[model samples]
Target: FAKFANVNDATSHWPTGEEVFTHLPGTHAHAPLIYVALMTFILIISSVTMVLAVEAGHRMDKKAVIKWMAWTVVGGLIFLGSQVWEWSTFIAGYDGDISTWADNGTLSHSPYGGQWVMGVDAHGHEVKQMVTYGPTLYANFFFFITGFHGFHVFTGVLFNFLVLRNVIRGVYHKRGHYEMVEKVGLYWHFVDLVWVFVFTFFYLV
Candidate 1:
């Protein structure tokens, strides 16, 4: 829908239609991107820990595998917690009314700030209305896509915990291998890679 959007059309713009459907520079909501960078770093480090765990498993070192897997699990937990905080903050909106726009020949006000309202248009089509405070669609996509990835992280942690349990039980040792650790490590690393792309496209860009 965004590809063929009419950039000059007022309907294409946000609430009050003073601006288009894109992040404007110098806006208050365009705060520092530090948290996203930190999240990326955390996930990337977790991938490295998974790699170390896999290497330890390859060498039949149960103690080393347990240590590295524990670190990887810790990293995943931290990342998931941070994502929850970010979602909460976004849903809460900004502190005060920030929507300002020039309509026709006069300035007007949209008091809701970044809040989004849904209603039927005159033509009976469903519409997602946004104020000048920020893009509502952006928040929607962010929540859905990032929330999905966060769920993946949560499940990856569970998988890691299960393998860690088996490691402690000497199951892999009895089998003369730690293939389970390697498999879970691969899944965890793939989760990290997906986050890297999401962070880059959603937060950084």
Candidate 2:
């Protein structure tokens, strides 16, 4: 990648690597896969809980509905929290030593960039350099996409919380059915399924 960037920098007449880093979209090659996998797992489990809640609602099982709904809410919270951690780590960027060549034919070490590069030092020892200043658009688009989904999760949590509160107050019990749980369950399921697409296109693909 470093060689490619250097060759492009040397040849390109248009905007190239010499200027601000140019970022292309759909580059999930370096994304944290394990964290994404965990989040997917949690959301899938939450969807299952929603299905169980809807079934309990059909049977007018208030206790079962409340229990499953609570579990769903917990799952949503955990997913959101994981996202917070992931975002923080991403924004922090990579931490490593970098190498740069000066105009005076001298090489030096730096901590500027997080990307790795191979080079030789004054003693003819091979060393690794890091590339800094990643493309801004990549991070911007990432935040926009993930942040939007995070907001949806936040609202879903609040919605579930309200319904859970009502359940505890016996409103559904007096009404002789847990229809509200079923309704919210539908929305929750939709959100969970949409996230699968987001995870695939944004993180895995």
Question: Which candidate has the top score in lDDT?
Answer: 1
TM-score of each: 0.70, 0.68
Give the TM-score comparing model 1 with the true structure, all chains together.
0.70
Candidate 1 Cα misplacement greater than 4 A, ranges: 1-31, 94-136
lDDT of 2 by residue, 72-109 (tens): 99999999988886665454432321123422223322
Q: Give per-residue CA lDDT, model 1, range 86-167, as digits (tens).
A: 6655555433322323322211233366443333331212222333233445445656778889999999999999999899
- Top candidate on TM-score is 1
Instruction: Count backbone overlaps in model 1.
Output: 0
Candidate 2's error at 36, in angstroms? 0.9
Off by over 4 Å in 2: 1-32, 94-135
After superposition on all C-alphas, the RMSD of every candidate to the true structure, in Å, is: 7.4, 9.8
> Candidate 1, which ten residues in sequence have the lowest lDDT sum?
16-25
